[model samples]
Target: MKYVVGLLLALACLQAQATEEQTVVLISIDGFRHDYIELHGAPNIAKIAEQGVRSEGLIPVYPSKTFPNHISIVTGQYPSNHGIVDNNFYDTERKQRYKMGDGVKDSTWLTTLPIWNLAEFQGVKAATFFWPESEARINGRTPSYYFNYSTPAPNRQRIDQIVEWLKLPEAARPRLVTGYFSIVDTMGHRFGPESHQVAKAVKHVDELIGELWQRIHDETEVPVNLILVSDHGMSQITAKDMIDVKELNIDEELFEIVNASTRLMIYPKEDVSADQIQQLEQRLKQKQGNFVIESEQQLAQLGVTDGPRKPAIVLGTTAPATFTTRPEEQRKDGGTHGFHSSRDMDGLFVAAGPAIQQGTQINRFSNIHIYPFMAKLLELELMTEIDGDAEVLTPIIR
Candidate 1:
C-alpha cells in the first residue's frame, strides 16, 4: 500500500511539471508600423523575427485606431461585434459617451471576452502589465495579476514585474502574460511618423524588449513563447488638411458629431426624421472636401454592424486629412491613424519561442485572428464563438 501511494504522488508531480513547461508572453508596442523594424532598426526584434516567425504585416480592422484594434487582437472580434467602435463614441441607448482612458473600468460596454479572461476561466492563470480594458472585470473575471492603466509607470518596471510573475512557484505562476508600451505611439503622434523622434522612440523600445528577452531566456525555468504586435501604424497629417463639419452649414441640433481624426461618426438627434437625416447626408455630399460619406453597404463591408452605437452616417478620408469642429484653431502637424485599412495603417507581428517555427514568414492577416492563435498556445479552449480562426495562424505553430 505504501509503495502504491508513493507511485501515485510521483505521477501527480509529473503532470504538474508537464503543465508548467509552456508559457506565452504577449507584448504590444503601440504604433509600431510594419516597416518600423527595417526603417528604425530594431536589432533585437529583428533577431526574434529571424529566429522565429514574422509577417509581412498585420492588417488592422477598419478605422485603424488604438483601442479598437488592441481589443480586436485580444477578443478576436471586430469593433462592431466588440462594442468599442472607436476610442471615443457615443452610445445613444445608454445616453453615455465613452472616452479612451475613462471608460475602461466599465465592462458593460464590452460584448466579448478577452484572451486573459478566457485563460483564467479555463483554470490557467494570467497576468497583464497593461492592455486596453485589462483592468476591467469582464464577466466577473480579471487577470490574477494586473495593474490599473497608468502612463506614469516606467516601461522597464513593467517588464521587471512580468519577469517576477514568471519566477513564482509553479502553482502560483501565471502561464499567460501581457505587456504594453506606448512610447512609440506617443512619439509618432507628437512628431510625424518620419521624424527623428519616432525613430529614437523605436530604438528605445527595442532595447527594452531585448532586455526582457534576455532575462526570460536566462532566468526562467519555464520556456517562454514571445508574441509581439502593434495596434496600428501612423501617417503624417497637417493642419491644412483638416476638414471642419461646420463648413457644411448644417443645423447643429440635427446630429451629434464624433470626430475620430480620419473619420467622423454622425448620430442623428432623437427627434430628427429620416428625411431630415437624408437631407443632412445630401448636404455633406454636396460640400465634401477631403472626405466621403460612407453608405450602409460600405459600413457593412468594413465590419460595422447596425446598432445604437453605430452612427447614421460615416465620413471617411483616404488622404492625410482629419475631421474637426474647430476650424479656426489650426491643428498641430503630426502623425495620426484611425484611417481605413491601407498600407499606411498596417501594424507588426512577430512570434518566437519553443512553440513557434523558426525563420518563417507569413502573409498579412487580420488582427482578429491573433486571439485564437494565442489561445492555442496557452492550450485553452475558447468559451464562446469568436471571429478569429486559429487555422489562419496554425501553420506557424510548431
Candidate 2:
C-alpha cells in the first residue's frame, strides 16, 4: 500500500510539473473558410499545417455566427449554454435584447466555465487579446491579462502587442493566450468570399500571423502551443441575395438583426404569439427563399442552441448566396455566415506546436470541441467536462 501511495504522489508531482511546462496560444482568424489555407492565399496557415495538425473543417457552433461560436471556443459550451445565441437576439424571458456588445457584461449570465476561468482555478495564467466578450470581467474576475475589442486598431499592432505580452516577466507571463483577427470577416462582409477583396484580406491576415509567429518562436524561452482557429466560415454574396427587411414589415418587436447578413435574431411582439411568429418565419422564408428556419428548440438539439435571451427563430441563408441589409444604395451585395454547420458552412481549424501531429486532417469537429484539443495541448484540466464533447486530438499528439 505504501508503494502504491508513493507512486500516486510521484505521479501528482510529475503532472504538476508537466502543466507548468505547457503554453497555449490561440489565434482566432475570423471568417476563415476551410479553403483559405488551401486556396494559396494563406501561406502562413499552410505552413502551420506543415508543422502541426490540420483539419478539413472545424464545424462551428450552431447559428454559425461570430459571437456565439467565438464564445463557444473558450467556454466549451454551445450557444444554448454560453448564452450568445446569435450576434444579437431578443431574450423571450428577459424581455430584453442581448447583442454581442454590452450583452455579456455580466459573467454570471454564462453558465459554463470559460477556459481562462478554469485555468485560473488550476493556478495557470491566461490572457485574451481581442477575443469577443473579453473587454470586461465576468463575475468580477478576468483573465490574467486582456485587451478589449479595439476595432480600428491595426492588425500589425495587435500582433505586436500579443508578441510583446508573451515577453512579459515570469510573474506577468500568461500560460495561455488567445488572439483575434477580424479582417477576413470584415472583408467578407464588404465583398463576397470569392471576390478579390476577400482574397486580399486573407493574404493580409496571413502575413500578420506570420509576423506574430516569428516573434513567438524567436522571443519566448518556453516552447508554446499555438491554435489557429476561426469562429465560422464565410459565404459569397451578391446584390441579388440581399434582403430588404423594410419590405417584410419586420417586427422590430419580433426580430432585431445586428450582424444583418450572416445571422438574425428573431423575436415576436407581445409574448409568445404563435400565429404571428409562424407568419414571421413564413415571411422570412418567402423573402429569403429556401433558408432554413430554426426555432430555439431545434437549434439546441443541433448542438449550437442559444440561451433564454435568444429570439424565437433563427434562419440560415442556404442558397449559393449570402445575406446583407442596405436601404438606399444597392440594398445588397455582401457575404456572411450564421448558416447551419453543413458543408456550405465549414470553418477553419489548425494546430501547430510541439505536441501536434503533422500532415493530417482532424475530422469535422465544432469550435466548442476545441477546448479538449486546447486543454490537451497546454496540459490543463478542464473546468468541467460538461461544456461540449471534444476529442483530445491524440492524432496530433505523439
**Best of the candidates, lDDT:** 1
lDDT for each residue of candidate 1 in 109-169, tens digit (9 for 90 to 100): 8888999999999888999999998888888888999999999999999989999999999
Model 2 lowest lDDT segment of ten: 254-263
Stretches of model 1 off by over 4 angstroms after superposition: 1-21, 327-329
Candidate 2 local lDDT, 52-115, one digit each (tens) = 7888888887778888888889888877777776676666666676667663466555566678
lDDT of 1: 0.89
In angstroms, give how far residue 83 of model 1 lies from its true place.
Answer: 1.0
Clashing pairs in 1: none
Cα-based TM-score, every candidate: 0.93, 0.85
